[model samples]
Target: MHLFSENLAVEIATYYRNVALGHSVVPKVFTLVNGSGSQYLFFIDDLQMERADEDQFLAYIVQEHDAVSYSRGTLVIVEKNQQYIEFAVVDEDDSEAIVCSAELTRDMDDKPIGLSEFEKILVKRESIVFGHLYDPVKLSEEKIEDFESLWEEMKPKILHRTMGV
Candidate 1:
């Protein structure tokens, strides 16, 4: 099945936006297919991250989601007491997965655009799969150092799972 549909993304975003109002953090929505033939739309706020211990976090997720089924074209909302809400669809399998996200933003440029200008904008917003994308507003070097440290802490754990070491 196609991973992303623009219309679907907009609808999902809108629905979550209402439910997520007044939350401390911008809610994150993730569409994932598990090892089983199940698909899920997970919406979680970062605030929950602050209070959850490792075991509580694991338990919360495990108990909240289990193998379930949904109609092919129906969107089901799950009301669970946890960090985020979930919508589930099952009976589909995925060997590989890719993610796409979209946000409507006002164009900041105040100048007329020709072909060259348009190409520049596209390049600026282009997604980079393996490395950081171009950012007009650069982060401070100190901030970069802090981010690098955080990445280092998780890098080995990720590599161990992804590389099967």
Candidate 2:
């Protein structure tokens, strides 16, 4: 996993849009799971999480998204089709965000994705260049149990909205 570039992110969104063309509904939120490993990304809408730190962190977000605001959040992009889950935690300060943390579940016999040494090197480089970090760690079963909890909570709401029920 490596940090997501703006172009790459747009490509991903385009990929999904193409996939949904005349086949599936275009989901308002984006959730892409890296089947080869526990790496995935999802979009957050109407977020309600409490701010644990400074109130101004996400203060710049506006109805219309811009390039500068786009870089405000963390970005992680995984290479094609590997058993990995990738997560990017958005923060006001890129350094303050955990550039490389949160490991995806690995398949048996699959080489681990995020190595501390490798991550250290990447993090160091990214820190210097203001590049994003995309390191995926291995997690205990219990730790990642709630990874899809957001989707679970939203499923019903999405269904209702989509179905007009």
Candidate 3:
């Protein structure tokens, strides 16, 4: 998370900032996929409870990401609807944050990756990145292994506990 983003600053401020106290806001959705083409969705809507715990978990995960991350930063998980996950980086002192998204996407040929399609033209895309190791969103062998192990650790704690196997 060294090159972390500040893209979600506006959203955090508009929805989560408190003038007197610190600020906290759920940015958007984030998604995950199990090996067998099943999906798990996670997010914090207006109704969800234990916001602090969820946010803490997200920050921990991002910090513990097998890849090299920052020394003193965390990815606050705000929401997750599908494979596309949105994380918020918030600044309580300044009400600023960066948006990080992990999505299941397709190539130019237009075919779905990981998750099986529900219909003919639905969520179809194969290449997904939990952590963009470098620009252009390509991952190496070590990074892939890191992702797998991380997924294993995260399986049970995830919000939507669904297994496709």
Q: What C-alpha RMSD separates each model from the true structure?
A: 17.2, 17.7, 18.1
Clashes of each: 0, 13, 17
What's each prediction's TM-score? 0.26, 0.23, 0.24
Q: For model 3, how does the per-residue alpha-carbon lDDT over 76-120 read when each residue is reduced to its tens digit?
A: 334332333233342222222244333333344433233222111
- Looking at model 3, which ten-residue stretch has the lowest summed lDDT? 117-126
Error of 3 at 100 (Å): 17
lDDT tens digits, residue span 1-165, model 1: 233222233344454444344332234443322334344444333214442232233222333333221111111223221122222222222222222222222123411111110000111111222111111224467745554554355434321111010
> Model 2: runs farther than 4 Å from truth?
1-32, 37-42, 52-150, 156-165
Supply candidate 3's per-residue lDDT for 19. Answer: 16
Model 1 segments more than 4 A misplaced: 1-26, 30-43, 50-64, 68-92, 106-165
Candidate achieving the largest lDDT:
3
Candidate 2 vs candidate 3: the lDDT winner is: 3
What digit string (tens of lDDT, one per residue) describes model 2 on residues 29-130? 322212122222333433455442111212212111121212222223374333222222232234432222222223354433331111211233244222
lDDT of each: 0.29, 0.29, 0.33
Which 10-residue span in candidate 2 carries the lowest summed lDDT? Answer: 60-69
